[model samples]
Target: MKIQHFTNQLHLLKEDESTTRKGAFIVLSAICLVGCLTFVSLAVDIGYINLVKTRMQNAVDAAALAAAQEITNAVNTAPVGTADVTQYSRDQARIAAKDVASLNDVFIDKQIDVIFGRRSFNESTQEFDVTWNASPSNVVKVIARRDNNDTSAQDGKLKLFFAGVTGDRYSTIVAQAVAYVESRDIVVVHDFSRSMNFDSYFNNESSARLSDSQIEQNLELVWNDLQMPNTGSLAFTPQYLTTTKSDYGVSATVTFKYDDLEVTSAGEIEKVQVKYTDNSYQTFNGLSGNSVNINGSKNIETAWVTARGPSENEPVTVTNNGISVTYAANRKSATMSSPQRIRELYVGFTDNSTDYRSYGSNGPYNASYSSWKEMDYMYLEVLDGRSYWYYFNAPNGGNEVTLQFDDSNWEVKQAFGLTGSYPYPRGSWDGFINHARNYSEFSSRGFRETYGGLTLMNYILRDYPGHWETPDLWKTRHFPFHAIKEGHLLLCDFLEDLGFDDHLGMVSYDTSHRQEKTMYDSDPNVPSVNISSEPITDNYQAIRDLMQYKQAAHYSYATNMGGGLEDGIQMILDNSRAGARRTILLMTDGNTNTMDSGASSSLPHGWDWDELFDYDGDGNSDYYTNSSQRRYVLRTAYDAVQNGITVHTMSVGIDADRNLMRAIAHLAGGHFIDVPGGASVADMESEVEQAFHRIASFVPPAKLMNQD
Candidate 1:
């Protein structure tokens, strides 16, 4: 009975304990289920909020960028020199931003916040600041957001998931951005050195234009005024003739004929050379002429005169020893021009000896020397002036030389040009020496204080550039300024592309852009022709006009980059618009230099002055070069920086002052353009145009700005 009672009590106690364990397990399982559901809700809500936030940021950035692009388009298409940042421009930008922002997916369509303002840099803080305004805005600010207070246009906050949420059921997100276009004012400065045309070539047409009288004028200027010293000279002794037929054919005589002059060709006899069958010949070089002594190893062989000029005029004639010369039958005219020559009478060339052209077989003859007495003459011939530098003027340069002819042979003297008994002071080139002589543009550059004698043409007729000016230099047509001018025009086109307000003006310099006097202010009896202009301007045509009809005519022919930069700076100070970025593009091709300004002018007074100056006009005075000139230039660059101008420098060739240009660019906060030299004019020109475009690209593009 006692054992049964104890077992029943124990079993009852075990049953109660088991029931308690079951209830506890149910409560713990329910809690774990609730915790897992809560974690999933948190993840979904957090991820959705993050995705919405990212989308919002992208929307605003894209909207701001789109708006900025709209403004840029307006600026580019509008006529240049118009009002900047107009209301219509800003309005269009805002519309673009709103349209771009609205397409984005938030909870719903959001109302974007758009604002216009001017953005500028703060010097004190070294940061950009935006000034909000209704007009003249350069910047656009955009804000994209969710959870707007205005329920009608709100992009509602992100909704919570997992069927329900207790508090704060939605999350708001926002993004913002700013973008702008820059306004700028720019100028181009030129280094107008004579050497600027050194590597240039005749790129213009030389055809029907030849028919026009302009051809003659062009020839004169190209062969004279803009002439550059390129060829060296050899010792020459001119041969004289007592009669037109004397002295030239001293041995075995040979006849000569010149190539015909044609509407299409500027032809002349390059040489009247005589050769023997052994190929031995008399060299008739400097100031070439007719009739040569062709005694071959003393054995007379076939001899002929070679007419040379343009390749179009090349023709060969063959004859045994005694050659009867005849001009080509086909000719433009048989007109004997003043100071006649063999080339002047025949108007065309011929290759067919059988069907040859003709016009006065032996060609234009100089006037008759039938008169008996001796007479003096002065024939302007282009002579290489280096040898006579110390003798003439000590070096303002030129090739237009006139000689005091004293060939005792009366016949020869009359055949050339010897009029009445006109007397120039009895001396060779200079009646007396001029210590400081004026020539061409250097009239005011140096004063003639001392006098002496310089016999430039004690002997007449010397060939310069070898072929004389008849047509050698004309055919080569090396005009570098043409390429330079084209480059300038392209820059103007780019300015047109930038839509006007960017503005452009130019000033050229060598010593100074100031043409206070005429280029060849050659006459001292008259007042110097004064030239001046506002430092800068937006008149595109005016700048182009200034460049037109110009070829390195600066007096002293020295480069003064600082003076040019100074002019540019003044242009900005005097003409640039407020809020416009002032900038300059400085171009050059030389070591920096200038003539001394302290020297005064005296001999430019009368014919007495004429007597004082050497015929070739290179007077005695020194060109000064020192560190001060360099400092002056650098100071100009620094002054540019002080006046809020940036100067980008370009050295046009291998020879340009790269260091100085680089220093100037660096000081004024700009770039240095390189000029890897080239062998052809086309290549050099292409580089110049490309450089202009490169700088054009520097006119700051529309960009995203930091909202901060």
Candidate 2:
């Protein structure tokens, strides 16, 4: 009976123990399942949250940059002093940020804050600060936030499955970013019109006139004004002839023909014709003649005489009875009761064959002299009457003389008026010496100063192999500045050596404005551009080609400073290049002669000239003077500064308005480089190139404020 009772109790105890074990197992399994679910939720949901946060950060960053860019665009496009906080909010930046922020399923709880203020980097503290609401805000900042309280961002809140069991429903996330407008896009406004031909020293075209005079003076110095004769002396011993009267009581008349004049090989007078009319005249060559009448003149005698020269080739011939030659002379002279009268004289050039080069055959005098070695300069006098002298330069001699004559009759012909200006001075020592001295000095000084800027620029930009051989010395010595002489520069080859990659563009203006080159192609409609609005490339060769071939426009003598500034500013007002700093290199070598017309109907987007600079209050076409142009430049610069565009001014020569350039630089918050007036064209080129380098090397002081 006891054994049976103990077994029943054991069985009951076993049943209770089984029940306790089952309950404990069930409780532990429930806890394990709950813990596993919590771990899975933490891994997957937390990963997703982290990813969302990354995307949100990117969105905010983009938002900040967009906002900053909008401010820049506003400043660039709006008229000077017209950009405000309202314009910033209305710009594409705010809209761009909002769109980007929503890309990652993150939405802002409220409108993004677009703040325009000053952003500065503190060197002492090594920190950046952005002060909000600063007047004339040049920096743009954007702040974006999201929480569950905002319906738009609530969908992106961290949703937890197991974490809810821990009494947590969702996790809130927020992201913020800031960006400051910086200047990067640059437009180099260069003067390439005809007037750039003006000198760096003087202000107007008067200098060019002086240059021309100097050229003429130098030419004279080289050829005409020499103190010493370039060619050998022309001095020659003269010969004399005396004709004695055979009959002292009777008077005699003489007639000399043009055919009898002769010259020796040494350019000395050798033979001359003499005639006398007298019964007592005696001839030296045994010839006798009665009273001769010439051209209706009675009582005329004739004789052919030879002067005593080194060569005794011919004998003297004279009429006999009335006159006799006591002694032979180069020129014939007669001692007669009646004085002799010269009716005419002739001069000509002879060929090597001693044949006359007739005036008809020889062409002009200078032409005849070039072909023939010998020329006869003749002189004649009518006793106690007017004397006449000339250089007879005729091809077939002259067809007619003072007396009836022909080319074949005589080699000599009377020359009437043959004096004129000469390429090289000749004749008297006074005129020749004066011109020769002046020409010599002028040649030493070199030719006229180079005037055309395009020509000079082409020389400066040429490639040279010698530059690389000694690169260090080339740069240190500023070789380009020193190497220019007579418009040639040895430093031209160094342009390729510079190897710079800065984005470059050009704007040329005179009476009108034209976009020469741009970082981005803005004019696709123009036939030259096949692709519309194509991004600018880094092709230095192409850039150089544009500069070399197409930089300068036609000569419009007018200078429109306001128009150029407006166009240059337009080049940097691009939204695609936002977040990059904008700059304008305004280089001018002259004053203003025209002004911008506030007409936007004929312009493209970003080409609103009136919006950029309004010189006259009338709001119509108005001409700007020097003073008004300066005001316009300053006003444009002010607008650029407010829009974060730095404008650097380079007054290449004296004519470039100095004070205006300084003011523009000051107001635009850009570096002012005075390549300062008074440099030669070559020197201006060197300094201008150096100024470009300075601008390229310049690092804008910390454009980003509080950058992380």
- lDDT: which candidate is best? 1
* Candidate 2 Cα misplacement greater than 4 A, ranges: 1-183, 200-501, 518-532, 535-537, 550-555, 599-626, 702-708
Candidate number achieving the greatest TM-score relative to the actual structure: 1
Instruction: Kindly state the number of residue pairs that clash in model 1.
Output: 20
Error of 2 at 10 (Å): 38
Give stretches of model 1 more than 4 Å off: 1-178, 200-479, 515-538, 554-556, 595-626, 701-708
How well is each residue in 157-189 modelled by candidate 1, as lDDT tens digits?
Answer: 556565265457666677777777665667788
TM-score to true structure, per model: 0.43, 0.35
Model 2 agreement with the true structure over 618-704: per-residue lDDT tens digits: 554222223655556556666677677788877655456766676567557677777653323344556666566565545344233
lDDT for model 1 comes to 0.48
lDDT (0-100) at residue 115 of candidate 1?
79
